[model samples]
Structures are given as C-alpha cells and as structure tokens.
Target: MRSTNFCLSTEGADVILATSSDEKYPPENIIDGQSETFWTTTGMFPQEFVICFHKCVIISKLTIQCYLVQTLRIEKSMSKDPVDFEHCIEKDLEYKEGELQTEEFSFPEFQATHLRFIILSAFDTFVSVHRVIAEGIAQDI
Candidate 1:
C-alpha cells in the first residue's frame, strides 16, 4: 500500500533551538514556507538546529533549502526527547551564487522523533536556512 505523505512542520513539529537566535531571523522562519524569510546564524561555523516531531514518523525523504551552506550533517533521534541522535547523513553543498542551495535526500523509510541539522561550514560567515521539508508518514503510537 502507498502511504500518504506529510510535511513535519504541518504535523506539529516546532520550536527548534539554534546556536544563536536573532529576533529578525528566528529559527521558526525555516518552516514558514517563505523563501524570502530564513533562519540566519551569527558568530561562527557549526550552527545547528533540532526539529522535533509531535510523534514518531517513518521519514522517506528530507529536503532543505538554504543559502551559503558549504557542508551539512543530519542526525536522527528515536528517543522521546531530542537527545542521543545518530548520524544519518552528511552533505557537501554546492554554491549557487545568488540562488538557494536546495538539497534533497531520499532514504529508506526510518523511524525518528527528532532530526538535527548541523551546518558544518559555509561559503560565508553566516548561513541562512529558508525551509526544511520532511516527507513521511506518521507512525501510530
């Protein structure tokens, strides 16, 4: 049977933590579905954020839209809380000059309650994440 797909943000995933927070560029902007608005990091490299789903989900694919990101690493946590994540994937992004660098990862369905996205490095000092879309089906608890 083909399972229905959903975006984690619309499934109640929320309130992520960023290495640094700016009122004008809050982490929440990443899910607002607006390319013009984004979550920007300040101070240094290795900026990270965690998105917690309301419940466990079997994620089939993950996509990220951003700018200036050079390298990214993604981790997953099956715990009830956002802790103890295992490495899922790491990517070296290509620069697009003046466009968004969109990265899509298709994986075998896997269970997860939380996902961590770490910006390991960037083409510039700051990086902006425009949106994060996780396509999956929610697992019944």
Candidate 2:
C-alpha cells in the first residue's frame, strides 16, 4: 500500500500549501500571462484513507456561481525506480456573479501520496466553502 496527497484551491485567489507561496493553477494548455510554476504539495500521505479540507488557504467570505471541472491524476511508477506519484493540479471550481454551486467528484483508486485541487473560475476574490472531504478505500482487482 502507498500514500496520497491532497491539494485544493479557489479561483482568482492565490493559495499556499504546507508552507509555500500563494500560487494559482493555470488553465489546461492555455497560458495567457499567468505564472507557469503553480504551487503544489509533496507526498503528504502514505496509505488508503480520507483527507478533509474545509479551509481554502485564502480566508475570505465571498461566494460565486459557475461550472466546475476537477481533474485527479496518478504519476507513472516503475519498479526499478523509486515510486513517486505526481498528481497534477486542476482547475475545478467555477463561478459566475454571486451564486454558489456544488461540483461533486470521485477519483479512481490509485496509490498516491499527494493530492492537488485547482480552482478554474469564480466571480469574486474569495472562495466560499462549507466542508470538504476525501475518502479512500482498497481497490477490488
């Protein structure tokens, strides 16, 4: 068994994980004039389990309404080389003016030690979140 890492963020808002700088995830294959080196997390977990994140690094009480597209990935690993998982950050949350919408997602089972959350778009400057949860179970293969 391995571990997993988690990353979550809000749109238009910079975020700092563990003890890093505020960085935003860029759009897929789109680079207008934003920073390329977005911040992400290292291996934070090492087993099948659930991790919850209710607070987005940025602390503000603003909400918006928009569509969300979240993506979770597992890096390739070779038996000869040290097992290292690379979960790319994705733009998930979406918002328009000042409304709230829910986007629920589940990932296929994988042995990872890192997780990253990316906020695609939002209306305002802050991200409004009530509760965030992560659950992991053994894969039946």
Candidate topping lDDT: 1
lDDT of 2 by residue, 3-101 (tens): 212222322211222222223522220111122222222222211111122322211121212222222221222122223435432334544443435
lDDT digits (tens) for residues 46-127 of candidate 1: 9999988868989898989999999999999999988899999999999978999999999998999888999999999899
Candidate 1 local accuracy as lDDT? 0.85
| Superposition-based RMSD of candidate 2 using all C-alpha atoms, in angstroms | 14.1
TM-score of each: 0.93, 0.32
Worst 10 residues of 1 by lDDT: 1-10
The Cα error of candidate 2 at residue 80, in Å, is 18
lDDT of each: 0.85, 0.28
